[model samples]
Target chain A: MSSTDMLQVISKNGKAKRGAEPNLPKKTLLAMYEAMMQTRLLDERMINLQRQGRIGFYVPSTGEEAAQVGSCMALDDTDWLFPSYRVPGLFLMRGVDIQHLVANCFGNEADLCKGRQMPVHYAFAEHKLVSISSPIGTHIIHATGLAMAQKLKKDKGISAVYFGDGGTSSNDFHSGLNFAGVAKAPVLFICTNNQWAISVPIEKQTASETIAIKGEAYGMPGVRVDGNDVLAVYDACKKAADRARKGDGPTLIELMTYRRGPHSSSDDPTRYRGNQADEWLDRDPILRFRKYLEVADMWSEKQETELIERLKAGINAEVKKGEAAGQPSLETMFTDVYANVPPHLREQYENLVRDEGTGHEPDPDAAFPL
Target chain B: MSSITMVQAVNDALREEMRGDDDVVVLGEDVGINGGVFRCTADLIDEFGEERVIDTPLSESGIIGAAVGMALYGLKPVPEIQFSDFIWPAFDQITSEMAKMRYRSGGQFTCPMVVRTPYGGGIRGGHYHSQSPEAYFTHTPGLVVVIPSDPYDAKGLLKAAIRCEDPVIFLEPKRIYRAPKMDVPDDDDYVVEIGKAAVRREGTDFTITAYGAMVAVALEACEKAAEQGWSGEVVDLRTLLPLDEDAIIQSVTKTGRLVTLQEATKFCGFSSEISAIVAEKAIDVLEAPVKRVSGFDVPFPYTLEHVYMPHADRVLKAIEGVMTY
Candidate 1:
């Protein structure tokens, strides 16, 4: 009786019920199901590759695909995505090429960032994916900056920032949220409450009953959604996105999802809490949406099999293409740090080139002005 | 032109910039009615009204974050950190957020703002108030750091910073705020661009490169050496970013001996930056290694305030050391 009936459409019974909200149009529901499947397969491949030592490091959005893809589907491509480290699923949904993802994952020559950053740190400059950095909450402050610019440019656009519940405790987060609140910047802040920051839990992170309620102090509406239910998250984000585009200011949407996988390839969720993360598997976002698709006569086992086979082939092709580009050599380390490579760096670069000659340079002939 | 202290010149520039640009705003602790602890914001709240001249809470992060917000909102926000030493609380906001906002956003945004803070030792303000921490901000990207040496440059450069399209860290030489008085223009639009250096005195013997209070100290040392027939040229590096390497290289090339002076601790200070430039670009031009007369790495002490700061005597000694070598 206590909060059993929240924002959900296809309940856990695997049957269509009378009282639940009506399903969406066939195309829309099927697309959501497709995105969830792709996210799961992509994340699974990356995790396995990491375990095989084929990739450097990775942070997966495994159990939280519904939170990421569902929220992204609500956003327009013109809107911005200022994500932190752990949201590769968002980039995939935002139309990042699977091969480009593999290139970045391998830190290869064809990577857009030129192999400067670690794997899983993807940035789609043309698609409005603000470059992701390794820092925890720094991107939140930048989201405020971008929202401010959007308002100044009178673009009538919104910026949705993604971070975990843990980042809400950082100074940059506090300053960013406080600034956004005061300026009434057009932004949709989606906190993917995966419930664990590495090993720390939501209880230790804040004493507040819920992270969304903290948005009240900033003078904005806060909405909570059942992060496992794709429809709930999608509906909440759509509403928030609309409010932002209409210049109604910001909205804080707390998606109560779970990180079913380990925090990263390097982490072990079992080291801290075992059954909680594994239990979320039964409520797997991808499976739940699949069930919804089947019940609504939008999907079938035959179509599911074909779609997965296509995704696997696509991923394999990207891996081969990325490996063909090869890793950056040593000289790659020295560029893109500053507008002009200052004389000190130049001298050091020359010294390094002289010290090792062309044999050790990362990209010897690749020279360009800043 | 009327004679006023360096601090007043800064205050006059802020007042004029606000009057000129309707978007200009001033915010900080004690910066409103109290005219700031050093009176830099004196009469500002009265002239500009409360909205433009805001007195904010003691939170440095809040002040800087608010300023960045205002800048993004199409307003020119100039926040005061009160003292360079107290700026650490806002370091995250400045370094991570404000500095990289423009570049990270791929030029989609810009922060035309300023963080004004008093720096250096002379008032015995101990470790808390007397530290010259401009080195911290200078190391950050997208931040234009400028430290004026006298009244004239302070007025010109501050107007420049107020009009700049990037975030500027204006470090006022607290030690020389009232030390030397000079003629600063009243109201006409004048600006010294960032990345340019000024030759305070031209000579062919020893080239002394310095900024902020050390520029005054270098000038004093130049005069003292001139009495002993040791000709000296003094360079006041007004802007640290886009550093005037051309002027510095020219002077060091001409004199064949140079002395770099700063109040910051010797390690990783601007002095080291200048030295690296000289070493990399014009290694053969030096008669002796570029001698750095900087404050020791020890924390700025209240008791030995005079000894701790880079003084006129240290300036002269460093120059003499370079000249003799």
Candidate 2:
């Protein structure tokens, strides 16, 4: 497809175009709609928790649910995902435990990261989901590297990495694409062009006509898809993944979407841009997908109310469990810095315990031999 | 055992590791067919083929970032950064991502990779090609910093680093890459333990602490001090972080006087950390104040490299000054 031409399956009014619907199983389509809805609800609850001072901070992907969920659903179980901080749907769709994810946000004792990282920087190795960092576009090369390793091992798995429009300007974006192109690494570069990166618009992030077109210079096919249409995104991503698995090299996909919320709890988008009009609001991915499901006789107002009620109660219980988990043990600060704790860290830990009047005795064997 | 140069020893370590472990792969600019700029990875591509021995694009961040991903995916990647001076481009990947991978992921993910780079000055490489950038990596936690003074230690330490569970910044003293041949073992199982210091000489007057290329300079200075009727000890710190404080303290307590030498600048260099450790742990047994002989606080000059780098005479002066004080 041309860079300027967008591949859209579902229309803005929630009607599928003629012969454009993806051939996914009914169960898969229902699952995709549920995941998108769950993501939207979770984001709203997390933001409310942040505002209530129950959590420190959160990044809400309000309007970009289809981009995150659809692209993640296209991958096989063995494939790897390197996600941006905004894409919490990727974690949920990958089958991460909701309680674990909530605990990570609370940085509680049950948190897998041991409260070491900031909230939303979730890491689940079982799902083949790489950890998230705050740096933009850095993980792009990492996805390429993982894909290269898979290719070398003759493995059937490919890697997919996500970034925003602003990430297009990062040095690693160029490096990752150029290197992956040269190596013929089986990976997909997915950019969720959500119109605004913080306060900067996409026009200011790049001078190119579109982010997808930039892939042409790196020797990769560029495709643009409707981010509000889950079926379209799934079709594009699955096709790209199949090409990568077949050793045909990488593909660049631009998911045309919009961020309908603030950058974070701390950001004030009102200071920079005017209110988003109703035209943009009507294109919400969850709304469009819900319409599509209803048109297919798959969903109704009764089912929608029940799903929302069940999700709300379930999310609330997980949040309560996370809150009641308590803070991570003080000693967790020193652990995981290395495979074995060196003498220096041991001494420091001892000093901290003594200073805190915890009366904790030093374990002679705890320190690794120097 | 066979006598070999430091570069040859490095090559032997990579070859053995790759042959032993199918997961160990080597990648960098000119590392495949060209066998690296210093020939440290020579003939690796011939044995491992193009899949394992990769010649990547000339992007430092790309090389290191890709290595991080490879390591995360269960491959032991040894990425060479042509020179330590050019390593700044990948500094974010090393410090932010690779070093923090295990901690940030709560031990679910780990980056077990070694970043091999040639460092330090003596070959008139000027500012760009020669620099002692160990202080940067040493200051960052969750990273193992290792340097070797000779071929035997280079091969052994590199092999150990490859097997390490944490990320390692293996700085090779490029100036001594072709130094006098030393007997490096050919056995595949031979490996040196990390976080250990080797006492090269025994002395009663003072102790000289050094690592990498400075170990040879310290040894030369020790001989000069002995010729002047003064005894000095030489300690080679194989690992910079998680320092072998016991070895340092033991040597300092015996000799009473201390002299720290490094090729990096004196201000906030690795030598400062050494001096501080001695002051904190073994201050009561000191005969005189610890002295540091290091490069001046100036950029490495091409024509004046001999003046920029610390020599035996400078180290000898520090030893005499500390002993007399």
Candidate 3:
């Protein structure tokens, strides 16, 4: 009954608990498994690529796939998403091409962001997913605001924002949740409690029993779920989405999970973490979900092995295409400041063009020495 | 054309833009039934209804955060911050989120919103209500900062800002909201382009560059200079960011002297940037060093307000310093 108690459906042994059968179509469940498998493969491959110096950076979403993919599946195509750095599963679920994502990592010309942002800081307007910003919890307010706009227009669409346990401690998270509560904006605040923010543990982040309880202070229903259970995550997110579409206010769902890898390729978990990764590996969401499907007579070991081979070949082709696109042209710096370049920017651009291949024009009256 | 106060001009611009574009919505604290604390959004709710004229909670961050969302969702949100002093709560949303939305998103997203707030020190609202925060917004790259000196410019620039594709910080000079009413064009489509300065007066002796309420102070200082046999030209820098550098350079070239005035703290203020620009480009033609008249680096105090603010006397002194150097 307490909020800290995890809301779970499928048990670790792949058995459905009392009144917890999600009744999802066999095809739908299999699709969820495939998406999770793809995410797992991409996470592993990207890490290898980053370590191999083929890509600049990567943020692996190994343990949190169920939370990311399940919640993403709950929203309609018209709904907007404000994702953080670790939600590549959400992007993949949105039907974004794997090549486009790899291109972003390469900072290639094919990258829509044009090498402006980091590898996993992806965005797609066509899919209505707002770009992921590096600043933690900053997108919560944006998600709230976007939902408010939808509410004003009497649109049934809602916004689902994803953050981590580290994000719940930020002022932006408070401001965003409080506003959504006051405005009665249709929004779902999804906190992927992976138990660590780079180096800081969740115990150090908050004294509260769970991040979901923090939603009560902001006048929203808070739910905690076994994030490793795909059925539980999907059920909770679907209920929250239904409430938002029905004019109910925001809901905060804390997906309880763990980080099964280093925070990013740049980090060294060995320095800070001990046996946690090994411990979480046993409760791997993908493996547990695969057990659920296999118990239901829907999935087999051969199917998974085949799916992985297909995903690897697909990922390899995409990585090769992304690498071949190369970096964006050097002339992209002066554009996009405004819809129309003003005269001053035009002059500066012209100056750069005139001084091509030479060093920048030196200012004789430089405020400080260069 | 009709004679109107700065507040009326702002109100007219909002009404006109909302009438023209259904996507344009007005929102802020007390912006609905209360019609804004300063009446800048008076009766907008009555005309546009509650959906468009949103009365948000007393949360500056919420107002801006929601406005950014609305803009990102293909709506033109003109959010009022009530007072410039109270905008700090939403500063993160404005600078990091709203300003960077375009560039960071690689042009796939744009926040075409106008943040309107009454600023400057004159009505003795104490420190909490009297601060010029344009320099902070101007420091940002993707944002356009607009400060209009009079009713005509206020109406024109607000309309222009609403039409601009990028985010704009429209600073309304609260001190002159009702003073010196001028005839503003009634045309609904009239707009003063952003990033352009209006030369209010032309002279041969020296250049006085100012904007918002200080432009009036500069005009008074120019009057005093005329009595002293010194001619002065006044350039109203309607837009602060993407500054009208050409206008500054031309005025300084003709007069060979520059005097910049602003109500914000002089340290790293807009006046400092303008002074630096003139000094850098027109240094050889200058008859004297560029002089800056600005508020001292101190919190706006309740009493001794005049001493804290840049007044006509200070502008005149700067003119004298620049002319006689």
Say which candidate scores most in lDDT. Answer: 2
Fnat of every candidate, listed in order: 0.10, 0.85, 0.64
Off by over 4 Å in 2: A359-370
Q: Please state the error at residue A116 of candidate 2 in Å.
A: 0.9
Which parts of model 3 are misplaced by more than 4 Å?
A358-370
Per-model chain A TM: 0.91, 0.95, 0.95
> Lowest-scoring 10 consecutive residues by lDDT in candidate 3 chain A?
A361-370
Candidate 1 differs from the real structure by a C-alpha RMSD in angstroms, to one decimal, of: 4.9
Of the candidates numbered 1 and 3, which has the greater lDDT value? 3
Candidate 2 backbone collisions, by pair: none
TM-score winner between 1 and 2, please give it: 2
Candidate 3 clashing pairs? none
TM-score attained by model 3: 0.95
| lDDT of every predicted structure (CA atoms) | 0.79, 0.91, 0.88
- Model 2 vs. true fold: TM: 0.98
Q: Who wins the DockQ comparison?
A: 2
Clash pairs detected, candidate 1: A329-A362, A330-A362, A331-A362
lDDT of 3 by residue, B1-325 (tens): 9999999999999999999998999988899998899898999888999889988877888789888988988899999999999999888888888988887778899998999999999989889999999999988878899999999999999999999998999999999999889999999979998889999999999999899999889999999999999999999999988899999999999999989889889899999998888777889989898888889899988898978998887788888898888
